[model samples]
Target: MDTPNRLAAAVSPYLLAHARDPVDWHEWGDEAFAAARRRDVPILLSVGYSACHWCHVMARESFSDPATAELINRSFVAVKVDREERPDLDRIYLDAVTALTGRAGWPLTAFLTPSGEPFFGGTYFPREARHGLPAFTAVLAAVSEAWRGRRSEVAAAGAALARRLASPPPTADADPGPDALGAVYRALERDFDPVHGGFGEAPKFPPAAALEFLLRITDASDAPRAAPMVQATLAAMADGGIHDQIGGGFSRYAVDRRWLVPHFEKMLYDNALLGRLYTRAAQVTGDPGVAGVARTTLDYLVDDLGLPDGGFAASEDADSEGEEGRFYVFTWAEFLAASGDAASLAAPVLGAAPEGNFEGRIVLHRARPAEAVARDAGTDSAEVEEAVVAALEGLRALRANRVRPERDDKAVAAWNGLAIRALAESATVLGEPRYLEAAVRAARFALAELRRPDGRLLRSRRAGRGDVPAFCEDYGAVALGLFALFRADGDPAWFDQAGGLVEDMIDLFGDGTDGGFFATGRDAPSLIARPLNLSDHPTPSDNALAAEALLTLAAYTGEARYGERAAAVFRVAGRLFEGAPTAVAHLAGILAVALAPARELAVVGPAGHPTTAALLAVAEESFRPDLFVAWGDGHCDGGIPLLQGRVALEGRPTAYLCRGHTCTGPTMDAAELRRLLTRRFRLSDGERRVGP
Candidate 1:
């Protein structure tokens, strides 16, 4: 057996997985760079996450081979980094690769100078030459030769790339107006796959931020394409194979445009974002079917990903038992045996074939809607639904007995924050107390485990150890989550913690002169460049999320500084929003919020009073993205400006609606409050199309 490398003591599961490889792998840090300098060799930086299938493939193909390992060890200082744990480095180098090549992805392989400047890189080199790509060893040999023979050229190239990366992104001081939103809608319409219900072509990822922006479109007439696009995509995904039929969550992305075949890794952030989207969709459409999907998705978070510490896991691996999708797919015989008599009735609806739809196994998807299935089978829709549910339950039970996929049990602060907000909002929207309870527990866990003595958040926690200093995104996301919890349960502690986090976020990551937050904090380890994350990727950018949280805090406290800071962030992000609105959809949505008329609603009543419930229900019934709600009992104390001097009228529950300095209401009647909200929010009465 090969002896373990330096990765044996690492906190990341991705690093630990490579411990027994033949290559002498070093954890990403100054140590590896120093060693490279001493050895007069280039640094081979391998960046990937634990759940990446191609990362695993590259490991087994080359890193595990003794000859290949020997070549790498002799020629370079091999450093392995978990991208999730070190996203700043990943962003810097991935940007380098995209600039050098045309695209980039996981199993990111970059060759850098001893001082840590990326010179050349590409993703996932094959062990041997195949499919028009050079072999991994051949590439390594060539890079080694270039370092030795073409020393001056390599050094110059590295220097040039470093300078390019260190430069700041484009900026526009102009504020985004309604025109920005209109332009984004047009772009999305042009890319919308009307038939398959996604943007662009094959290999579609879920457009979480885009869907969110679409949902916030207030004027349906201005952006007619928004509603149909969101509805079609959500409905398609809910019925597609990418959405696990037996398990209640989504895979990373679909390999095909139709959402039929997924990549199979389940990410916590994806489910959190999608679950919250579906929940909002339910509110907009008033469709029980959409609500059901939301419930199941949120349930999956707690049941499958929830850790013993009340924090959620980062991801579930794509591969299990040495094969990708082995844990998820089933052969015809196995499906039949597990599903029993229901197989005959369920197979057609589930798109299951005797020959199988994927690798001689069935990846369950809804081939037809229940109504259509009932029409074909000569039965009622309810009966068909009942049979399908029963069959799926049986299949789920059977699959539970199989070897489960390895989970990356690290609980990342940013992802956990996403989960916390999703659950908190869903609990109120879906009327599920358990979801609220789960959210509170997760929020508490994050506060207790992922914070320093100074109240700064850590990047992640694994096995009760959190060693990494928090990034801008961590602070932003957690602050947002805590604020959501406060709104859900009216907890003063949550509000206080959230406010402090926002302050820390500004102090640690805010670039005062640049008018935006940096991806890394001031205290974080130095990198080649300090990138400003301003566009939405798999998660919202740090700047966008922080700006959002700041804006919300400003609204509640009536503080000008917070709003000014958010405006500054918008100025920096403006060019990106205008140039590629779809890429910065989250920023666009937040911009919309900033531009929209600010209306504050404060409800004053006892916590469990029926009148208070009625008043709160009326306010929550419709989507009010522009309106901020501050609810409290008559005698509550939290120092919230919005809640100050709010009291029930005539010893009954009351609501106060304010716009800027103008204040109205103190009405005890729920109907009166509904009317006020209806006018303020422009509540729609017809079939809900889109626009929160």
Candidate 2:
């Protein structure tokens, strides 16, 4: 066994992967910076995650090479950072990298001063000069020379970057009104591919957040016109190669606009968001196809991404057997051997080319249906369909024996929170109890394992350790998860737990003088400056999620203070939301909740009553973004303020739809309650998308 480096003592799986390298790597800490200062050299900072393929390439090409390692060890202090573990550091440095290089990505290479300030950086560099870029060793030599010779210039750049990092971020010039959302939709309309369904040209992302935002604004009336975009995109993704045609789950993003061929990595957050997005869309439109996609995504999580301890795994590496897409892609000979009668019929249907598209192999995608393929091949449609199904099952079985993508076993708190919310909400909308149970199981595991006794949420759990203090997203998302659990089963304990988290979050990360919550706690080891990040990065933004947690807690507890704090948060970020509504889509969602003053729907009946389930189903199926639900057994005397004084009408199941502390009317008929919710969706009668 090789001697482990400083990173062996670290918790991040990504960092530990490099602990055996000869680069003399130090984990991101003051100790690394102190070493740089003592050695009188610049700090070589490299930040990447476990699922990143390029990070591995750099490790193999340069960090593992003794010559490169000796050069780095002699001339610079090498620091390796797991971006997932310390997003605060990632955010600050990524901003600087972008400011310096005009672009940024994983395997981020940056030159920092002894004091942890970035002066020059870029994404992946080759070991030697190639592909229009200088080699990594050449870069190290140049930076070292610059540090030694032109020390003043390097120091000036670092100081200037530090100042830029400390400056406040730009906000929206105006309040985020309906016009802001309308503008984003108009832009979406411009970029949406009429042929492929997703926005833009090649390299398409699912746009889950954007799709969900559209779902919310669908029909300031009963019929939402923006639905075609969402429907088209989902259908395109389902039929595309990016979705696992043999297994279940979609990939990270498509490499081509036609949704054929993907980056191959699978992230927990993407699936979670996609599952909830599809499930909610199904509930709104009653589309069985969309519902199926949601089911497939959730099942994939359960079957492929689950951990032994009940927590979900963070991600699956994009590579298997040290080759990217090997397990996922198939060759022509292999396909023919695997599928006999179905080979000819399925080949073209699965978009297999004669010459092959990906490194002499085909990346499978269902470009056409079995029926279509049968027509082209002059075969029976029924037989072709059956054959295709059989072939898929056989392929899946054959692939099972192949080495699988490395699973990152770390259960990240923020990502888990996203998972729990997805599962719980999908359970309600899909009427699937198993999904709800999965949500509860994850929530319990996160709370019990990732939470500190002092009420701090840890970032990730790996090999029975919960070390890193929770960031802003952890608090926001986990609290939201607990709130979802409470609503799903009407448990006061979950609500109380969520409420406690909200209070602690406020104490730790709140900005009393400013409006939005900071990205780190007050007690957090100081970076150059505390970042108040509001932009979305695949998942919802911290400020947006924070607003959601507080606003929801306010609705449940009927506390104006929590609501006021959320309002304060909005005051600061209004312009940012208004200008780039798509980037802050979740904030737009939460803001709608706040402006609607949020409706409270209380269903009171016996837990086991059949009538209760009927009403609950109605509540679940209805798309009420501005409303929160409280289910009870006619006993609302506990911690849930929204449930207080709500009772079944004449012992029959009843629903009370309240706005501020007052119920509009009590109804025993589920149909009547559904009608009331439908009315809330109408745009006429002065009904705004949110509040009037």
Candidate 3:
């Protein structure tokens, strides 16, 4: 029988997976650092998340090996961290590794001092020396020797890293303006792959923020190119293997330039961001195909990732049965055998061949259009479409019989927040009440199960238990999600709760002198440094999300201080904007909101009135990141300042529009409301303000 280690008590699924490993692994916390100090040994920080393929690989290759485990246990105080749960450690250590080796990814291998200062690190060393990488044991031996023999050198490295992290980020020469948006857009255009769509070369991520940024671009001069880029990329991804042709969600990323192959792990955050992106794309382009894709992607979340407790899980693993992509792929014969009735019809459209596309198995992609298939088969396009749907249903049922990938059933607060935001927004846009209900349930779950009695939020919930303190990202994201729910259903409670969260975020994560927010909360356990995420790599950075939530709250409540704090975040992120525009894609979106005219829309009407619904529809018809919608019968029941003075005009449903606190007359006409929203106007001289 295998012995369970200290990791057996860990809440992290990743840590639990290694519970039976012979390695003396400690969870990231005071206990691990204390043990390291007591033993006078360097800490071996191994950071990775549940869904990371290489993380799984390294675990199986090294951690599972008794010999390797014995060496690790003897040489260092091994610590395991789930990056999803503790992004502060991930960010700090990832930076340290990147600084040391110029590149980084999971599983992150870092040598830290007892106090948690990272000195030397690299990613995924092999068990045996191969592929230009040294063996894990050899690297361990070298680090151990350096710690014991060359102690001063190790200390110097730690001190240097500490100094670098403690230093303030460089500020921009001037506050960015509308011109900064153009500069970033131009940079994106240069990096764009015209023929294949999306930016740069192979291994394409969803680029959710960048796509949203492009969709939000309303400039007449840039619209032509921007629209095509957004549409083409969306269309390309929908047809690609990366989009889970049999299922309905996307994988982590494509392995090829054309998105023909994927890494196969489906992440909750990716699906959340993509669902919202596609829903908006559908709104912008008025394409039913895009809308259909949005529905499936959003539905995928509730059906597959949703937990029993009303929250969604973090991710689904990439590998099943010890083979990557095994669960998602099928042989051409297997596809044809299971396709049934639509086999011949579906084969042409599904890119199935006797010679498979990926390792003797087919990674299904839409190779041919339904129209083309119908024409060649001497059938109607409608029939072809119907056949394709039937074929997909058959494929789904067949795939269900296979050994499925394991789900990391950890419901992360920040990820659930992202999911809630997507579901709420998509519910309104797609007219799907179920999505709204899901969002509401999720928000309620977070508030009830993940919140402390002291009003602070927890980082995650697993098996109905949560103890990890929430970070800045969690606060920002959950606030944004609740705010979206407020817009969808006009529940002032959600708005008030959202506002309260933003307040807590300010108090807990705000760096008063430096501006912006830290990844960890104020009272959370301290590490070597307070980590800050400046780039939106996997999701919106901590500060970007905070700034967005802050700006949104400010627009609704007329709070000047909220906007001021958001501006400070932009200032803190100025260097990133100047050098790596693409990296700060989400921040650019927030910056656009900051630069544009503040649009506050309030509808005063009786509940369940058609005129009121119509007015709200106009506001939701297009994507306006700057617009904040408030609906009430007459008074601001939730203390939303935007709706305080709003009332039904002439005893009928009325819509009021405000730009920078300057209001236009109320209108009961939906067409007039649309016109008011679409019309461009300059702010008053007194109301005009400079950019963040």
How many clashing pairs per prediction, in order? 0, 4, 0
List ranges where model 3 is wrong by over 4 Å. Answer: 377-379, 682-692
lDDT of 3 by residue, 1-692 (tens): 18899999999898999899999999987888889999999999999988889999998899999899988999899999999988888888898889889999899999998988888999999989999999999999999999999888888889899878766677676667666676667777888888778899988998998888788774434445778889999999999999988779999999889988999999999999999999999999899999999999999999999999999999999999999999988887778777878888887788888898989898889989989999999998898888777878877888999899999999999999999999999999999999999999999999998888888899998987779899999999999999999999998999989999999999999999878898888897666778878789789999889999999998998879999999888888887776888888888878877887789998888779999999999999888777899898875556888888777888899988997666798899999989888775443443223221
Question: Tens digits of per-residue lDDT for model 1 on 425-541?
Answer: 889989999999999989989999998877778999899876888889999899889988988888778889999999999999989786899999898878889988887878999
How would you encode candidate 2's per-residue C-alpha lDDT over 1-692 as one tens digit per residue? 18888888877788888889988899877789889888899999999988888888888899999999999999999999888888888888888999998998888898999988888999998888899989999989889999999999999999999988988766555455555556556666677788899888877888987787777777644224468888889889988888998878888888888888788889998998898888988877788988998999999987788887878998998899999888898888877777777777777777876677788898887767777888887887787777777777767877989999998889999989988988988888887899898888898899899988866789999989858899989999889988998889888888888898899889999987767889999989978878988778777888888998998988777889998888777777776655665677667666655655467888888888988888888888867777888888886645688888777778898888887767788888888988887765333446665322
Candidate 2 — number of clashing residue pairs? 4
In model 1, the clashing pairs are: none
Model number with the top TM-score: 1
Against the reference, the lDDT scores of all candidates come to 0.87, 0.83, 0.88
Model 2: weakest 10-residue lDDT segment is: 683-692
**Which run of 10 residues does model 3 get worst, by summed lDDT?**
683-692
| Candidate structures ordered by TM-score, highest first | 1, 3, 2
Error of 3 at 496 (Å): 0.8
